[model samples]
Target: MIWKEARNLYVNKWILFEAIEAYSEDGKRIVKDLSVINAYDDGKEALKEYREKHKKDKSREMYVYHTKNDELIIEERMWMGVRKNG
Candidate 1:
């Protein structure tokens, strides 16, 4: 479902979702299609779930968001760090 649809379905709640179809434009992550993983009353719970899922699968584009947001405008940031090779 789209962000708007998700927002409508899960009103006034925190949700953990996977971005199935998305793109970056003007330093923003625009999610076109997504799948809702779970809903929560608290943002922290959603974030916790997102972290666990992300840790298990780094490839998946997952996020925690509140349905109160009118737009799903995620700011994209470049990760700047040196990684030591194992």
Candidate 2:
């Protein structure tokens, strides 16, 4: 997986981030992973390190997000289906 980072605007916190593949049918972006590798007080420094790691693996998916929380806020949703088989 790719390496990424996110910053908390209010608290001024930086965190490493990544996204994982999830099932999808249409052109809509689905589930993702916000795994926190580490946290930093300086956003610039955190981003600098994140860039270096990203450069190493350019083939993986990564993102840098600035949100209220340093980590990603995951929301659970129920999927509707036809039935369950034994």
Candidate 3:
């Protein structure tokens, strides 16, 4: 019901944010951006405000995707011929 603080990482930086499912004027699915409440965003206070804002929209969905420095899964083929021989 409430917009939880959603966090993601980009370029090794933590990007804390929140989103509430909303339909644009033309009825297009969209996510409304809420300001970052805390530095790392604990999602406590922000969720409260988001619920209050779109209380009537029962169909709306709040999504939170957690990321930390972002772990990258790399394959050996990606490195091509630059890898050192062991």
Candidate 4:
């Protein structure tokens, strides 16, 4: 489903979804098509679930977001190098 449709369906809730079709534009991720995995009352819970799922299958594009936002404005970042602990 689209972001608008998902927002309508799950109001004032945290949703964990997988981006089926998406693209990066202007340093932001624009999800064109998505599938809702689950809905949660808390953002932390949604994030925890997202982490687990992501760890299991790194290939899948998943995100946790609240429905209160009008649009999905995910900022894209580029990681330059690996972090080293001293």
**Best candidate, lDDT-wise?**
4
TM value for model 2: 0.48
lDDT of 4: 0.95
The lDDT values for all models are 0.94, 0.54, 0.38, 0.95
Model 2 bad stretches (over 4 Å): 1-12, 22-31, 67-86
lDDT of 3 by residue, 1-86 (tens): 22332334222223333443344443343445544333324445445655664476655443323334232211222234675689
- Which 10-residue span in candidate 1 carries the lowest summed lDDT? 45-54
Q: How do the residues 3-86 of candidate 2 rate in per-residue lDDT, one tens digit apiece?
A: 223343234555555656643445443435446555676778768877997999977544444445533444445779899799
| Model 2, C-alpha of 37: deviation from truth (Å) | 1.9
Model 4 residue 9 CA deviation (Å) reads 0.7
lDDT of 1 by residue, 1-86 (tens): 99999999999999999999999999999999999999999999998988898999999999898999999989999999999999
TM per candidate comes to 0.92, 0.48, 0.27, 0.91
* Model 1 stretches astray by more than 4 angstroms: 83-86
Residue-level error in angstroms, candidate 3, position 9: 5.5
Q: Give the alpha carbon lDDT tens digit for every residue of 2-86 in model 4.
A: 9999999999999999999999999999999999999999999999999999999999999999999999888988989989999
| Candidate 4 error regions (>4 Å) | 83-86
| CA error at residue 44 for candidate 4, angstroms | 0.7
